[model samples]
Target chain A: MSDLDLLKYTCGRTDLSLICDLIDPGSSVLDLGCGDGLFLRYLKERKNVRSLGLEISAEKIASCIANGVPVIQGDLDSRMEFAADGDFDYVILSRTLQEVRHPENLLDEIVRVGKQAIVSFINFGYFEYRFELFFCGRMPRGRHLPYEWFNTPNIHLGTLTDFHTLCRERHIRIVSAEPLGRIHGILPKWCWPNLFAHSCVFVLEKEK
Target chain B: MLLIEPQNYDFGPGEENALELDCRKKLYEVTLRYETCGKLNADRSNAVLIEHALSGDAHVTGYHTPEDRKPGWWAEMVGPGKAIDTDRYFVICSNILGGCSGSTGPRSIDPATGKPYNMNFPVITIADMVRAQKRLIDHLGISKLLAVVGGSMGGMQVLQWMIDYPDSVAAAVPIATTAQNSAQNIAFNWVGREAIISDPKFDGGNYDPENPPGKGLSTARMLAHITYLSDETMGRKFGRNLQENDHYAFDFRRDFAVESYLQHQGRRFVERFDANSYCYITRAIDYFDLADRTNGDLAAAFHSAKGKFLVVSFSSDWLFPTKQARALVKALLANHLETNFCEIQSGYGHDAFLLEIDTLGAMVGAFLANTLNEVSSGKQRGAQS
Candidate 1:
């Protein structure tokens, strides 16, 4: 298979296309927790944007370098003081916000270093998860949140309400919140998105 | 199979041209021995300066003589279609200021006294070595270089070049190096220096040329050679096998193959390296700390640097570990400079920079190509507007 085909097979998450669709051409981007830099490569090839990535895995970083994508081995939980204020047009955290130690601080850094942030995350308050917890009385488990509570990396999992509240408290402007309901059903236009949406993608900006 | 002839660029003769040492001393009549490969394009933007490590020299690649047993040190990474492909870029490698290989060091004559400088040779720093190279770069009539690349101590030079002449370098690749010398690094260097100084034949840095302090120098080299390798590589390469015997000699007369191998490495090193030169160069490395002038703020020290950067380290390079490379990458990023960092998996330890050419070479080749493309495209954009 070709590189693009391989990328699609490996990294074709539902939110990847959403994130790519939002980024404009000729803009600079920083991808946090960029796995194998598949999204960044896709952006570079199609959108013609200058991009870089921060990946924690050495193995993934090797793949990124082999494909000529620039990446640094760094943790998203730590302070991103390395990046100057507004250094990038966009900073992307794809389904990795809940996995970080300090999601609040990371969000702050994201909006500070990047003019805008493109964030995608699984909604813990989806109808299926709420129903599971209400009936089974166990930690939510399904296609998205697959791991058991003990083995899961999604320690700070939150619902759409929690994210929106945090954004308000942080004085961040949520330009748009894209609700995706892949497993449950077709999401009705803006009808109880927090309960209906299985996942969400938010385009955020620091309040001027 | 191109034969490369070494060339010498002499400068620092007049008062205005005197090179200042970090020790607050100025030296005149300096010479830099260098070699060039490939061609310099019309715009002179294809130049890539390759810096050598502790014991490396100007002979980066190609044959000095066809009958010679081996090609230059980095022959694996620098020929046509290689990593820093000579076919695509003009490559320059020079013996560092304090290096023994044809570069002016303790072995060079002190014009005032008409004798070798020896102990009198001013202690240099990584910055000083880079400054000397800058003079050569100026003499070559090249205003900007496509990249400055190196590993180990050479990596330090590449870092210094980026900061010292930020406008001159389009990109830099500092491999297997640290922003500052660590305490353990200083400790290792101290032991080596003590070995050389305590040797009876050392004669206060005035040893005879015919029969130098071989024992001490050899011992130092042996210890350093150990640092360049890891426990895994040592076990895989030599283990505890007896040398030339199935059973142990049961004596101190070199039974293990590892001992014999170290002894061979030391002996060969002494034949080609000058003891005093080793002392000065290692001391220079010891004094190296990029953040010294900025009150220990590494990020502040790199505020003025401008260029894309590729920082590389090895998984097993404990001497200059991945942590150090991360620190540098952080500093570069703090300045909002374009930086790419990777810690390659290898069992070759600190010496992996020389051995893991396939991965290192690919990264370097891509980085250089990307940098060139950006530069040209930027220029074209500028022209159109």
Candidate 2:
């Protein structure tokens, strides 16, 4: 692939851009499953945020190193090597929640490490996906969920409401719940986002 | 800017001799050196210490004449107005103990033997590295540090400082590192060591000065370098791309660009780094079990530390994953120490901290500024009270 194509393949996603915009510039950040270190590099340059990436791939870690980004190759399910107690201002899980086997435990870990955790997931409850399930009787495929079911990394598919309910059940305080869609080239409203939006971004905190 | 070349200058009388440190039965000699820039003032609390990674030198940031080929590895972050802000902070980077970069290492002539210690050099741990740093700090007469920051093996030294001499550091930033090496990590190190020793030219860790263990060391570095990156990054950058044309050459020559790149990295590294030092340093990293040393409690290691900490990790970095950073947060919480953790979303793998300058720099700058403010205000309140 060309350099531009590689860059686009690694980055060039609207959801990442939106998430980057929402994050406070100077806040400490931890990006889980940060692919190719693009978003972290973006946040570092534009926002001046101290960031770390936790990826599971060796090649990505090398690229991060080549680019001079700080990264660690590790699984999210295991105990981290970082020294204990609320070490980060924010821990971000972008486009990685669904792929994890036990997201609830991961969320608990995120809340434990950061004061606030921003989790962005593709909303499977969106009308287009629902229509695909009802009409075609198969899993939906779109810009967000591009891969076929067999080859897809997304294992834990859930809707906006389902995530909201899970957060409430787990006593996770919803700092902000917003929906995202390509509207005349802008993000749409948070409420009834499933109707018009393709994805949901949830900024949550552990309820004391 | 006035360029200073301390390496070219001869050390004043007795400076060349190594100072012995006898800790009971353990005897070790620390080789001390310093490079001062601008003025040497006691009131200027802007002193910053840059701890180099394994096989790194004292040169933190600078370009040695264009033809010299090798530029400072961190030249991007440590310039006048750069993220490290050399104008504001008096940066002091040193080659660590057990390192080949002008510091005490296996190659140094042992005072007792009169010959190079070779593999017979005392096995030093991360704590030993920090202990040597403490001596350097004491000799410099810098009572408190503005910040102690490092990545990978350097990050391990940063952690050791916080644990060993808590009061000396004001802020600690350990990026893209683990508190201790795991079994898998140890295995990787072992493989690299074996690769070096298995080489015919290694000569039992004392390869001839003319022809050192270049082949094996390069191969070891190539293998280790591969582990430092992510699959996605490699796929995106190299992606089975051929070196010269579309078709792969059937011969043993590097068929893919990635293979060529690895070969280049390995060859370049062998030119600058020593083979034996790699074996010793990797062993030190494997023996670095901070929790075990602190009685199976990582929190206890930082219990007495009063300074604020910034632990950073990168997403997609499997070598030192976000979970390790989270465990650090948990330990710090248990200790009730003021801390901030950030997992930057980066696909840069283990090297994200060095690459993602915008995020890491900003976060470090802001965190340091805030912590310094807190420290000043607390001192002010105490004075008023």
Candidate 3:
């Protein structure tokens, strides 16, 4: 069974399943910032997809090797020199977009290497973040944003509407957008996603 | 703390054991010094080949005796209950073809001439070293190796092994090495070689048998030692601190602690290493470029290599940095081979593999165990079917 199928049986989170659903079986995958290769292992076992992973930590790379996952140690901020153009069917950057040096450049490289890219990140413009900034007068620290102000990797945090603008700006076609959490899932189509969504996932491909 | 002694295996019959080097010059009657800690299994499937880097010999681990000062070059990693684990796998480490220790090199007496080969020694390459080891393996009656593990120049041999005899290797761990020697690495080695050559006592690598080129060889080692350590590590170690004094001596004597350290290291190195072998080995390493060998197509070089690969590099190693390792990984991935690459963050530079034993041990140990299991499982399936 694939990770999606396993998660389905185990009552796992909806967002993870949604991301797996976006990918077709037996497709080539490149997972950026693949810590411990958890998702790649799942994809390999369930979807039977050809997968490669890039991570930065040595310990995590060892773990990936131990699990028989082909992983390369590299920083996400650097250009995708190892990955060839259109080499992968799907490039995943789940919860890593906010931590990247330049999200737009990274997304461009991702879409260049992969036919499509699945980017999932915690929405900075969400109600709780706004509440923390407004009421608490500090950077948000909750379930989604668990890190402290100094150590948090979320440098370029954006919301769903900002992503829509980015997609339009870059002439990228949005295949699908899935919102997660109690507030984000129930938001009306006409309403602003900035105020509702706690976390969001967007699958994008070039207009061509 | 437990030291083990190494046993030598000498075998040669002139032309019968001839090795043709890259330069097409055949070296006959070669003496390969080797040591095996663990026993060979019934099927000989659990044999691990450990290749040593430059300046390293067959004494990979274990002391000559209980009271011996140094156990081995890689004493920390390849011992009983250690990363290599003599308890599980039969480990074999041999001195390269052109090395000083007990191997036949420039210092060895040529059977035909009845004198040390010296300048007459055949110019050997990394591939030549692997070819020599292949003979040793055949003599041991081991058809296949569980894994070929090494760092730096040793890693070059691992790459040569995979490409030369792909079917013979099940897995490879090439740490702190590139697919080929970079221009910078070549340039650094060139400077070290120049140090030895420019010495007045070098005498065209045909120095007097009684007293070799000490000054030149020591100077060459001192220059090469700088490349092994990072600036940060050097600073942490010595940082301009005066040697045996609170202030500068303002004379020709070794002023800084770093200078004294280098002098000590250089002086100690010349005693064990042969200057002529240094020239041959460095030249051999400089000539190592797998890409050039395959007409600039690196991925195609591994066309027949079906083994799993683990390529490692140190972050601070400017000589064999992460960039080089990543390029190798990229080529392997391009060939659609199973590969794992990791750039370990360390203050130690190119010498991290030798220095950082804890992390290196665990990583190598885990990788070896996983490979051993896969090989056994495949054999089991083959037998049952």
TM-score of 1: 0.85
What tens digits encode model 3's per-residue C-alpha lDDT throughout A10-39?
254455667777789999898898887777
- Model 2 residue runs over 4 Å out of place are A1-208, B7-29, B33-44, B64-70, B376-385
Where model 3 places Cα greater than 4 Å from the true spot, the runs are A1-12, A125-141, A147-151, A183-197, B1-17, B379-385
Candidate numbers, best TM-score first, in rank order: 3, 1, 2
Error of 1 at B319 (Å): 0.6
Q: Single out the weakest 10-residue window by summed lDDT for candidate 1 chain B.
A: B376-385
Instruction: Judge candidate 2 at residue B245 and give its lDDT.
Output: 77
The C-alpha lDDT values of all candidates are: 0.89, 0.74, 0.84
Candidate 1 deviant stretches above 4 angstroms: A1-17, A20-28, A36-38, A41-51, A57-69, A75-90, A97-117, A123-176, A182-189, A192-198, A203-208, B245-248, B379-385
Total colliding residue pairs, candidate 3 = 2
The residue-by-residue lDDT of candidate 2 on A47-96, one tens digit each, is 87877778776556545543434555567886555623477788889878
Q: How many clashes does the backbone of model 2 have?
A: 95
True contacts kept of each: 0.60, 0.14, 0.62
Candidate 2 structure quality by residue, lDDT tens digits, B244-345: 978867899888999999999999989888888889899888988779767878877777766667788888888878777777766765665545566778
Q: What's the best-to-worst order under lDDT?
A: 1, 3, 2
What shift in Å separates residue A99 of candidate 2 from its native position after superposition?
A: 19
Residue B203, model 2: Cα distance from true site in angstroms = 1.6
Please compute DockQ, using alpha carbons, for every candidate against the native two-chain complex: 0.43, 0.09, 0.60
